[model samples]
Target: MDTQGIFDSSSTVRDCSTIFALSTLLSSVQIYNLKENVKEDDLQHLQLFTEYGKQLKKDNGKKPFQVLEFVIRDWQYDYDYAYGQSGGEELLAKRLEITEGMATELRELRQHIRSCFERVTCFLMPHPGFEVRKKSFAGEISKLDEEFKTALKELVPSILAPANLTPKLINGGRVTARDLFTYFKTYMTIFNSNTMPPIESIMKATSEAALLAAMQVARELYETRMARVTAGLSLPRPALQQEHVAALQAARAACIDKNKMASTKDVNESLARLTQELEALLPQYLLINDGNLQKALGEAKDAYEASVRRVHGADLLCVHPSDLQTIHNEAVAAALRVFDARRKQYPGIPDDNRTKLLESFLPRLDELNTLNNEHNRLFVADAKLSFMGEVERLLARDPPLGPYEFRNEYNRAKNRAVAAFKRRRNMPSTYYADVYEDDLLRSIENRYYIIREINRNT
Candidate 1:
């Protein structure tokens, strides 16, 4: 009778269903008859609905066996799946992200590594291959240098002896050591580079240059080794291939005793720089790649779950019929007991008093039997004639489920109220109630109208 109360209960039913819909895996809603043996598939659906309703009832301890509706929204991945496909889309995407990012970073580091190799190669040519120890040689000291000939060569040619001047001997075409000495006046005693700078010194410079070239070669080779090591370190957790062993071997070969031919400080500096670069970049490389992988996993969960949301159109979600039937059976048995007792008592009472007695007792008896049952089932459609319009509508409907024999009685009373209300523009509305109550009064009286009505002449 209370529209607001009815609407509130309906809203509660809707709320219970929405929460049930939040299940990531349930495929569809199925009304289950808890009394009948439900199929395994149907039981699964029923259990979900029951759990949702039970929790809500616990939260607000009001009612049970409520109607619940569920809606599922479908979704899928872009790269991991086609428009409506299914599979491990997120798993695939995560693998791609982690592996791909690491691979890209590995490629970037290789470029710098290659440049180092090229530089090392550039320095290798024209080094220890040429045995050019000629510059470090001292001049032929015994013959070329006539130690005390400074004054002696000066008398031979004052003209040739002049600074930056030279002369040759004429008698024997081959020049003597004395004549050679005379040709180079101060060069004989010039100390550092007298006649021509010694070949041995050039050889010394060549040896030093050759040594530095080898150091550069060694530096790059070790760097290449370090690059491979770093790449191996940065590889994704499960994607690591064998650490580039060849590169590692080459690095070990490149580590020469720099104290012999290269700067110890420079060798240490190169190793330090390599470590710094690896330390600075490795953490970021891992973090970004890992972050992308996690995001991919999350997307995958959503994609796989979308299938569950696609089916189960919204319609039947009521107290499962079986559960309802169980409650109904219990309520019916209890009501019949009361009705039976009252029926027996009605026959013993005087006729006029019996009608009033049954009317007074029937509604209360039905209410007692149904109150707990209605709460348990939380669904009801019994027509209570407590409202004016409702009584007329019930009269008009002649509802198929109502007792058929009571149809004429209900209609006769409904017609009388219609006739009475038509005159009530001037008459007070209370007059209609009087007429309505009087119609009920006659309906009750007609219950005892027996076989005597037929023969007015008799």
Candidate 2:
């Protein structure tokens, strides 16, 4: 009956008539919906109960109705409300609500159990394009998964339908012999779809662990980007400078040139040795910092070449009349600022390694920088570097406008960067413990956590 789920236990004499009316209404709905075959089937079961139940009573020498319907007080687990409009109607409403909620949830779950046969399909089947990060609609997929587990126990008795197909009839039990055949006919439809496997078996056949695997990647990427972007706000360097760049460049050029002249032979020899050391280094352990040291050597080499051509060609080194001019300018260094120019004003000659290569040469590079700074104090005209015109005309142009301001800034920055490189170099080797590599392996270990949780639950 359609009223199969709605049973009232409030046996009030006055309310009995109303209860009968409700029962009839439900029964009529059930009867209206029933197909002819299903009606005939139900009728057959009833007939067997009537005839066989009576025979059992005769054999056992006991009075009996058509069939047994014993009310087991302890076994009665009613989900429906016991309602007959009393002072305790609110309590009835609450119980009914709880029962209906649980059953509704169970029904929803069983639907998922059925649908999983569709979802947990063959591996080769093409997947629908739906993002797992969010539910597709009304949380159908999520609800289905939740329901499947809950429905497992409820489904066990269903297996009996298939087993009942083969039956042994006791004495005079003709209906039982035929009923088993009918039961199997119904069971075959449920069986052919292969939907009856236990949930664990289905999960094993389909490697559904990928669902959690994808979630882990999403979490890590979110954490990484959040860290990098926030870290940019706390950088140690100043925002980049736009002015005084010209003055800083002029001072650097003069410094490089001075070093080029004073230690020409020494620098060339050092460079040749450094290059040889580098070729050996790269083939063995490539980034052993050969690039950093070689870069500094190459800049020194270029400056030496420019100074040599002028000094070698003529016995008169500062040949042009303009060359004899004052060695002071705010924006451009006089030739003397660079001590290297003294030795390297001739081409094809190289520098030798001095016993105090770092001690002597590094001081000279600084001295040249100092000479440029001294010039920044004088308000001399901007001198055109070309060998041209009267000395008076050269001296009369506007002096370095902001030479002191810019070079001080550049010098400070260079000191900081070089200091940072030194600090990094002095640190102890990470290779002692191989910590970074260990951290990477540790990260991969975390990815299998989902499987561990499921195992613990089981």
Candidate 3:
């Protein structure tokens, strides 16, 4: 790979270095083109592999890639050197030894590449048949010399044949095309950001991608199953509840089952998404149920008040002491029945909708009961007034009867007034009734004494 570019030299240098570094990871076979010899300076490009060696060793163990050293113009016959029958590998090694100031660099290059690529095997291009003077473009393959053609024929099949250059393998498993694309894309992003993309980052990106894909699959699976089950229809609370829970469990199981290799975080993220999707189904149910809840509450209130009215009457004067609690109990029971009858229409996931109806209905029921008591108080007040009027009418009689006769008539009148007061009232509690009767008798006694004083004076 070329490591020289025209931009900011340092920036471009790092970019190119990073590119070369990642390229080693992707390639099964790496090639280096040289003009004549493996000079000391030519090894500079290989120096970039220094830091990645440990990472490569960890990933691939001792396995290595094939490296081809393609030396052009080396086969040209001259007075000092001539073509021989020696093997290309032997000739290249001999030439490296002869080159000045190349031994140390070559050894270091070998060591570094060994660490980075494990046991990399270097191949010299096969000897060419004939010499060509000019550089040729790749598009002119047909016009190239027979010697160049022969070299390519030997090189291409050596790497491309059968399992010679297999796809990148990680932990003994071949990487899929999708994984490879993700890797390259990650590397490019890091390269563009002027950062060296570490192997750890690449692995992390791969893991994140797997988790995201798993979450998506789980989400889709859950939605598909639920959609088919519900068919865009708003189901009752019990049916919806059963279906939601089952679908959520199956989706979570699918995510876990399909990606058993996923980490805890990955699995948790996918499960969280499933939960969210399950809850999403509830809004429609809630919307429909909210209306039902209101309707149920209204019905409960009406039922409670209707029962209260049947016993208390519109004036509410008929209520007795025991009627307060008894009426409330019966009303509450009726309200509960109202809610229970419509329970299927409301969402019950969070809480029983019946509770909501009772919460609202009970308070209003109490208020109605209070109104009944207030009206009953008015009834008691009216009875008291009527009793006082009868006593006053007896006192206002003209030409009062003689003392003994007046006493007899007063007793009879008081008895009749007490009976009349009792007849008009419904509250059986006699606490107020006794007090009013005592007041009437005391008033008549005072009148009787006054009549006796007048008779004695005459």
Candidate 2 clashes: the total is 17
Candidate with maximal lDDT? 3
* Clash statistics: count for each candidate: 12, 17, 1
State the weakest 10-residue window (summed lDDT) of model 2. 117-126
| TM-score of structure candidate 2 | 0.16
Off by over 4 Å in 2: 1-290, 311-458
Residue range 1-458, candidate 2, lDDT tens digits: 22332223655422432332222211211111111111223222223223333343444433222111111111111233211112123322232233344555434333332221111110011121243334555545443433232332332332235652322222222223233334234333323452343323222221112112212222233334333322312111111111112322333333233222223554344334433433342222222223322333344344433443333233212211122122112112322223332222223333332112234444544454454333322211111111112222322335421435333433343344333322322122323343222332343334324423432343
Model 2 superposed RMSD (Cα):
36.4
RMSD of each: 45.7, 36.4, 17.7
Predicted structure 3: lDDT: 0.57
lDDT by residue (248-330, candidate 3, tens digit) is 78877766764544468777877787678667876655565556667767777788878776664544444544556676788
lDDT minimum window of 10 residues, candidate 1:
118-127
lDDT of each: 0.32, 0.28, 0.57
